[model samples]
Target: MDNLQKCPQIVDILPTAEGQVRPMTKLEPQEQHEVWLRAVELAGGKVPTGRIVKDVVQKIMERTKVPNTYQIGEVCQILVKDNPELRGKGGCWGIVSAVNEFSCTLRMWDGEYTIGLQHLKSYNYLPAECEQMQVICDACGGLRLRINRVYSSGLEESVQKFLESLGKLNRASLTALEEKLLKVLESEIRD
Candidate 1:
């Protein structure tokens, strides 16, 4: 176990699918080692100087700048690797309710959050997929409001708070039974 702990962690290159491929550039072995060392230091929270880190980050940003920024109504997945506020919303999908120069206000299942561009990844979903996701979010919000109205035969803040506490149910994909239950809930809310 001690020997295992001494081994370095290996990073897989391009482990996930990306919308665009970055142009490959050749680097000497020494250059690659230096880059890896700097990355490891950053990951370990050992910043020698904020200004140096900022400059390096800016250069990297210039190289990897997105051609088009997010637009309103576009769907994006929240990347919470470095944002403590978005701790639990690591890969949750949200719709862009508002777009700013470097951030977006996303309308998620639970609520709206304004997140920086660094903490968002475009879903690159098809138009139909995006439309369906919007419908799901709208339906969920509408159903929650209806439930609040029906609870105790009046609109109640306590009921709304309780529903919000459910918080997306943390299900990556719905089970068949869950899908049926959602359909039933929607139908009940409609009536």
Candidate 2:
């Protein structure tokens, strides 16, 4: 690994699916070694990253344990604590329409999203509450055709907090809040 040379910058070399190619140009030999060392520590394995024959990423993924607790039609909020790209969707509720090894297909108010298991937080709600949320979820699923935009900074954060609050409401409180939320959504559609 120490003797590895920096590759050329020109289209460099395209890797074939059947062949073994290394990303020598992506990092210096020493830097590559450090990255591999870190990966080994993170994966708790002795796989060398400098070699192309080793499936380092696959091995790491195989060792990852994301519990499958999501169920179809269940209401859950999207968790986006560490995913900055998903900030706009933080705390957004969705219906789990499908479940896989490490993720779920969610039907949201704006659209459908395939979310990782770690990005889900289940909530226990009444049947009426589920019905109410389903309406919002459908609206959101269709909003992609109308609004077709991501939530902005202040709006995203506030929306997350607002939805979070809704989950904590009692039956009486939920009725009023759900009505208000539906009214707001309905109003938005008219304009």
Candidate 3:
């Protein structure tokens, strides 16, 4: 005997559409993933064929949407939750240079790096923190600053190793080093 709750009729649950899926170019990767999971659940957990999954996901993508949460000019931290490649690169700050469908390009002191949407989180910076970054950028020829990316640079290589901790700090938990580093950098720029 089939369980009524477990095997509910998919037809009744799913809206009847005109058999078309709109462009998914606008759907965020996370949204597309959710749509794919819903499609599988709709198929009774048998893992429907790839073609069916894709079609259903596309169809759902037409109805559902998720907006980009990260914005340009906002500071963001690289999260290594799922991407092992970023294992030791957490707590680093970067300026958002560009935003794409499922990723963003961040300009760092050395260069620009692109990270997928899943590997990013917003960094809450204090007013002073922002101005400090701008100061570093201005002094460095508007180039990216490496103060927060200490993970990439050995502590011994840091002009002031203490600055590396700033990246790990949030607006509410800023450290004195954050301010000191800005002051030091600004002074060095004057010379």
Candidate 4:
């Protein structure tokens, strides 16, 4: 009798004192109904024999769009206004020297300028902002001047040495020397 319970239908069967079998008593209705459904599914249409099907759908949809293009000269104009390094510096405009799908190079007055795809939106030219400014030596009392441009790193060390030598001179002589140096710088820039 215990061994018979291992069989699906036998577990659903009942026994009498003579050991005769009959249908089992109606069990929990809901549980029995679920079991019957699952058993039928297992038998393929009466029971689901193949793998269960699940929906594989994406939650997000991304935008796939391209950007617009501008003329070569138009891009150069924009860089002159927006890029700080190029602003107010005359002769820094030109046509787009080269361009690819993603970026373009502008032939600027200073050098070749490379810009990105997104940055192209702001490209346009403005009138030259200001005249070139000159740097006058404070010590020379307006005698020497140079272009207000970046100097090599080593040049700064030389300037510091010159300042130290000025410190060692007599007050009157140092003043004259400073003026002379300023005049020399002014001449160089003027040349």
Least well predicted 10-residue stretch by lDDT in candidate 4: 53-62
Per-residue accuracy of model 4 over 22-96 as CA lDDT, tens digit each: 111123444344433443334443322212110000000001223336444443443332235443432233346
Give the higher-lDDT candidate: 2 or 3. Answer: 3
RMSD of each: 11.6, 11.7, 11.2, 28.7
Candidate 1 lDDT score at position 38: 49
Candidates 2 and 4, the one with greater TM-score = 2
lDDT of 2 at 149: 30
lDDT of candidate 1 over 33-110, digit per residue (tens): 444344435545232243333334434544655444787788898887534788667777789999876578998765
Ranking by TM-score: 1, 2, 3, 4
Relative to the true structure, candidate 1 reaches a TM of: 0.48
TM-score of 3: 0.42
lDDT, each prediction:
0.57, 0.54, 0.56, 0.35
Instruction: Give lDDT tens digits, candidate 3, residues 78-119.
Output: 876534666546767676779986678976544678987656
Each prediction's TM-score against the native? 0.48, 0.45, 0.42, 0.26
Q: Clash totals for all models, in order?
A: 0, 5, 1, 19
Indicate which candidate wins on lDDT: 1
* Candidate 2 stretches greater than 4 Å from native: 1-66, 139-144, 149-191
lDDT of 2 at 133: 70
The full ranking of all candidates by lDDT, starting with the best, is 1, 3, 2, 4
